[model samples]
Target: MLQESHTAVIARGQHWRGEVATEPYEAAWAKEAIFFLRALKVEGSLQGTRANIQISADGIHWADEGSSLAVPTTAGEVTFCRISHFGGFLRLVVALPEGARIQVVASLNLKA
Candidate 1:
């Protein structure tokens, strides 16, 4: 049988400051998933910045799934993280340096 797959663009040309979480996605059918985060531009240092893949049951609350992406300091760089055994809803949460802003595009890829 062929596997099912899908990609969702959660954040598009959006500017992130301090900390932010991408919109939730429902993918209970998916057995595997990956998140791609692209930094288009940065207003300050990317030091100490991190992005984590979070899972949720009702889409309103979230918990870290231990899957994380190491955010690059350089602009135009892309980072990714893989996750599995996630319950249903998923999202990406990023914590950036204080007073720094990053314009980014976040994509969630899933397969079953």
Candidate 2:
């Protein structure tokens, strides 16, 4: 069978200084997805830079799927997490400590 897949750049070279959520992407057709966050530059504390996976039906409200992505802290490092059984929309809620910041890119890959 021919597989269909797509990738969305949720965040591009963006600087996150505090807790923030990546822009949600609609992927209802996908049977699987992988969320990636790459830290190109880091500042302040190195630990506790993680994200909570969230799903939404209408792309409006969201709830944690009880899964978290352990993001890389050092530059030139990448980390990802796979997810399934999702809703129409998906996003990651990243938590950053006070005075902590990271320049990174986030992407979501979908497969059907």
Candidate 3:
């Protein structure tokens, strides 16, 4: 006779965020989970810098989850976008002007 094995995993139910530069950044992969946008922080000196959010299932092809967000050229500026959706994977695609440098951070509330 053959038997099946079962295991249980405790859901993290925690929040996670990733930081990236203007050169383009991708977040870590998340398994069978849902996420909610908490906040976005933009810092550093640059011009016409923007942060774009994207989601993917295989990490090969990506789709824009939302519109491009404008980033302040100056520091001490934060944008709040509270959106919720379920995805197998999530990442960020940043756009910067020529010779522009900026730092972007995204926060997400994870649920299993």
Candidate 4:
């Protein structure tokens, strides 16, 4: 995790180089929030990968807020920016194929 004043940059989870069904990261923010998503270059065998942004009024129940984004499986990078108008909970959901090694970073800015 990294922080600059009110902004926070974090790795959703450990190096997702193993086989996992779904990796979800959650955080809380003000009513109006800014988010940045970036997928680092992945290594090793690659396959179908997907990611999406989700939000919720409560942490337990979440709803997809943005269109499903395809995650680059090869050695490349992808990024996305979003400004949320509702809900106080935000998360990034990523699906990695078996034998896929990936690293994703997320940054959150909370208005003062």
Candidate of highest lDDT: 2
Candidate 4 structure quality by residue, lDDT tens digits, 40-95: 76766555565566777776687878755566555445555555564566666775
Off by over 4 Å in 4: 1-5, 17-32, 39-41, 44-48, 68-78
Name the lDDT of candidate 4: 0.58
Per-prediction TM-score to the true structure, in the order listed: 0.93, 0.95, 0.49, 0.61
- For candidate 3, lDDT tens digit of each residue in 34-105? 222222333334455555667666767777877555555554555433334535555545555544454334
| Candidate closest to the true structure, highest TM-score | 2
The sequence of per-residue lDDT tens digits that candidate 1 reaches over residues 2-92 is 9999999999999899778888899999999889888899888887678988899999988889888977677889988888899899998
The full ranking of all candidates by TM-score, starting with the best, is: 2, 1, 4, 3
Superposed Cα deviation of residue 26, candidate 1 (Å): 0.7
* Better candidate by TM-score, 2 or 4: 2
Runs with alpha carbons beyond 4 Å of true place in candidate 2:
none
lDDT string for model 2 (24-68, tens) is 899999999999889989888858667899999888999998888
lDDT of each: 0.88, 0.88, 0.42, 0.58
Ranking by lDDT: 2, 1, 4, 3
Q: Which window of ten consecutive residues has the lowest lDDT sum in model 4? A: 18-27
- Residue 30 CA error for candidate 4 (Å)? 3.7
By the lDDT metric, which is better: model 3 or model 4? 4
Instruction: Report the C-alpha displacement of residue 64, candidate 3, in angstroms.
Output: 1.5
